[model samples]
Target: MTTDAVFDSPAVPGVPLPAFVQTLLWAGWPMEFLERAQERYGDVFHIHTLLFGKEVVLAHPEDVKEVFTGDPDQLRAGEANQPLEPLVGPRSVLLLDGPEHLRQRRLLLPPFHGERMLKYAAVMRETTAEDLARWPRGAVFSLHPHMQRVTLDIILRTIFGAEDPRDLTDLRAALSKVLDRLGSAFSTIATIPPLRFHLGGFSPWAIFQREMAAADKLVYARIAKRRAEGPREDVLSLLLSATDEEGKPLTDPELRDELMTLLVAGHETTATMLCWAFDLILSHPAVRDRLVEEVTGAEDPQRLPYLDAVLKEVLRMRPVIPAVGRRLSAPLTLRGRHYPTGTLLVPSSYLVHHNPEVYPDPKVFRPERFLDRKSDPYTFFPFGGGVRRCLGMAFAQFEMKVVLAEVFGRVKLKKARPGPAKVTVRVFTFAPEKGVEVVLEG
Candidate 1:
């Protein structure tokens, strides 16, 4: 699959900025890129970013159907998202194609299933409780950082059966640094291709490499220790027990890559969702009051009505993952447009989530829409769509609801300031730039 399409064409015709300038208009995309492009053009269009140096097609639901579910073989997850492909390594399900993706998904699916996910509810409840217990009453603090810590703990307990909170905390901090640096780094560094030796790309990537080495030493060491300790019911044990169609156990590198994929995918994005949810409810007094009402009468925060709706709406508004990219595996066309194979397409969560056609008054944050009816599942994808949908979606939703439940139920917090005042993306994920600061009154 290949394309002769040159990125020189503007983001859309008659737009003031070149595709390049429009891409660079804001750091790491102010909103989803396609969204800004739609404002400049209309539904169907293109957006450019320096790093990938490619133009991605942005589509509305009518256009997106083809790209997302249209031809699974024809439309593929592309190299535009390749930066992390290396870190996640070759066998990561996220970086695979067709049959390979299916196999990895099949192998990875059982442990993340219904009965299994139910076990995390208690972990979520207890972890959230532990974190909420330390919230200093009347003191303003950034919630996302705390949320990150909480999510990591949940992941450790659920995925690894980890109990030493301090060790997990250290691992989370180190991994957090690596992820935060990669998503949005300074201009020059983010765009460069990697070499065996050369210390620039994605903000002191050498330092990141050092951190990776340090984290790897720790993670792999744990893997060995756990191995000696004998079989357990955690994700690692599950992976060890998994057999491919060929009946082979996952290679060591495969195991590490899988762990990294789950760690990075599950950690930052869910934490961002919580951060955005905290800001969303705190800023909108009505939403907050309603949530308090729904959960107040309930004996447990996790069981409250409208709770999941609230999280979905939060994800819809400020989705943790702002964009997703896929390459053309086979030639395809959509929205009356044609493209050759390997044409890079980027989907904008910002635009799709804000599409007034799909979401009425897209700007307003409302949870009622979800309760009203079933809408197109593909359109409002925070966990992404298709087979590659996050392996941790259930875990993410559970963590968010459980943490929010515990906090809202026990810790009463109010936004310390006014306005969204700058709700934005950090690197690739959406988070408050000023950090969603709030004061806990309970």
Candidate 2:
């Protein structure tokens, strides 16, 4: 409990498997591993894995607070996220550290803020409405892909400023292909370093590079056009006009990396969260009735408190990104255990959310808990915390609320199958298995 007491404690208990075996298990069922480890080792443990060498898992709120609130100098998040470099690019904010990270974050923060976010809300509602209008009523269908399409449309329109019909179509097609390939191949490349090697065009890494190049071509073209034409309402235009403290403009490659980061992170996680929300709401009919009533009665659904609670509960029960990783840049003490500089400290969001000390009856799907009490950031963070907290947290949360309100208010829906939906791994996100099958009701 106290850092002094844990300072001399042994390194967190864990399985001592070879890196390859650990990688195999982690890729398949990381949540299961974390759950079992917590049950066996209490709140703190370790997983000696190749993904990031010796990774320690922390679940206690106190430990989480230390990790989130720790000095940026002592904990290097960018180095911890090195595996993501290939996908997000070297200049991505996700892969930057220290002063450079702060710079990129400041430059990117404006477009996702107040007035600009209001404009994006309009896009979110319109895009969701357009997508939902095409769904076959009174028929069972997988909801994940539907949610993905809507979120992708919103991102394309707001982030890339893809207004031309041809440009939108071409970029969407190219990005979709790239995403599909990445979804399948990223886990392998991320877990196994050797597999990331490029062996000509037929190799998976080579194929991924080709797909990214195709997507990049469209992105760079848009960047050039936006530069030539001047500023617009989209994020790309805003970034094009932005200048640092020294008045230095972002370069082409810098713009590409930032745009790619936004494109991928902006849509995918929101889509997964939406799918899980649908699955959770439909699984509990009473909750669904109350949510629908709240959404329908409110002139502005985003103002409905119960609806907000439901969203919070969904995120708590099943965070899209279950853990946030950090590597120690200096010797540090957590839960009384001293960790070396290279130690990989992963704060497990899934375990912390489920901790009974934090939430009584944690397994139960109860939104009222949120209504009754607020949770501290360290205990309930789904978007992570500290300087490395997700930059689009506000944007993602607003989009989910708007989209859910639009969908639930307009249509009656039910789960296609009985019992709780199975959870599965999709890329790095925990998704509702079977794509959260649901039937529309008249």
Candidate 3:
């Protein structure tokens, strides 16, 4: 639909703002915009923006459940996530639908299985400890960048299986460069058709292409090297050995794209959540003391209920990815209203997480609530829901627990800057404006 046509649509109700204006607001101030829109429009609303076009936002848990549990053939996440093709590649499981999606998902699932997490946990703890040792003492610094480094390092070792010092350093730098390029302002503008054209080497699209190419080159080289070697424990090794129903292993490009998907999907989201965890935890003395006590005293820190509750509360309050989208291919009715085929349905994780009906005193950070009760799948979906849910959910949460145990157990930290960290939109996810500044006191 054209930009002008979005304004005339009576099927969806939303803020009476122009597409350009809405896009600007969404790009600049997503949290405030979403909060205000939900307050005015209630649980359901629409956002007609230049970037996303018209997507109906569902804030109610029941509505979210219906869409999540709806027919995968009818509500397609792959089609809805088309814009990510440039970043993750066309062959990624994230971009595949129906049988193809299931096949790819099955091949990828084994690497992140519960047993495999035990192997990855060692990498996670070691990576966090190594990075924590490097953090400056008696000086204020942003923990966000540090968290990014640790998560990216963990992804490299655990996912890419990079063990050589030279290869690890090289791959880390290349991937970091690609992510930096992706987070640029011009990158968002490059999504628009008219502005997406590459003029020359220095052009925004050209620069992005170059960064991706560099990262892919390093990753492809690692894949080739790993292919020559025998089976190993890392995710890439399993993926290398994995064959579909036809007994055909993944091609080089397919491997590259899936690796890229894991990197893009796992890196920033987990890092941002870590930053928010520290931001939230440090601000609450009682929570911090309790968490530290549990982590420091526990025989196995990962099994502690309070630590898990703290992570859950952090995710509930600050979901890194606010919404998950599904595009309808068949007419469906939601909350008594009929939505036609081609409608975009977004389950707003941020809104549902903060809904007073679902979470009493939603604005407050209380880990005890989670300790007493388990959250409904539709209601607490930081990693999203249904078959399309993130493959790294288990890995990410496990890493969080391991890292939190390591951090709180070894060091004492205090927020360097007063007041809560302001939420800011960074590329596709929400992040702390100041990168969660803090200092080590001990």
The models' CA-based lDDT, in order, is 0.71, 0.83, 0.88
Q: Could you give me the TM-score of model 1 versus the true structure?
A: 0.90
The residue pairs that clash in candidate 2, if any, are 6-336, 6-337, 7-336
**Could you say which candidate leads in lDDT?**
3
Name the runs in model 2 displaced over 4 angstroms. 1-9, 17-21, 50-52, 190-192
Model 1 agreement with the true structure over 199-238: per-residue lDDT tens digits: 4543554655676787777677667766788767677778
The candidate that achieves the highest TM-score relative to the unseen native structure = 3
Candidate 1: regions farther than 4 A off: 1-20, 32-34, 165-170, 183-191, 194-196, 199-203, 297-303
lDDT of model 1, residue 206: 60
Cα lDDT tens digits, model 3, 13-117, are 688898999988987789999999998878888888887888889998999999888889899999988888888899999999999899899899999877679
TM-score for every candidate vs. truth? 0.90, 0.94, 0.96
- Which is the winner by lDDT between candidate 1 and candidate 2? 2
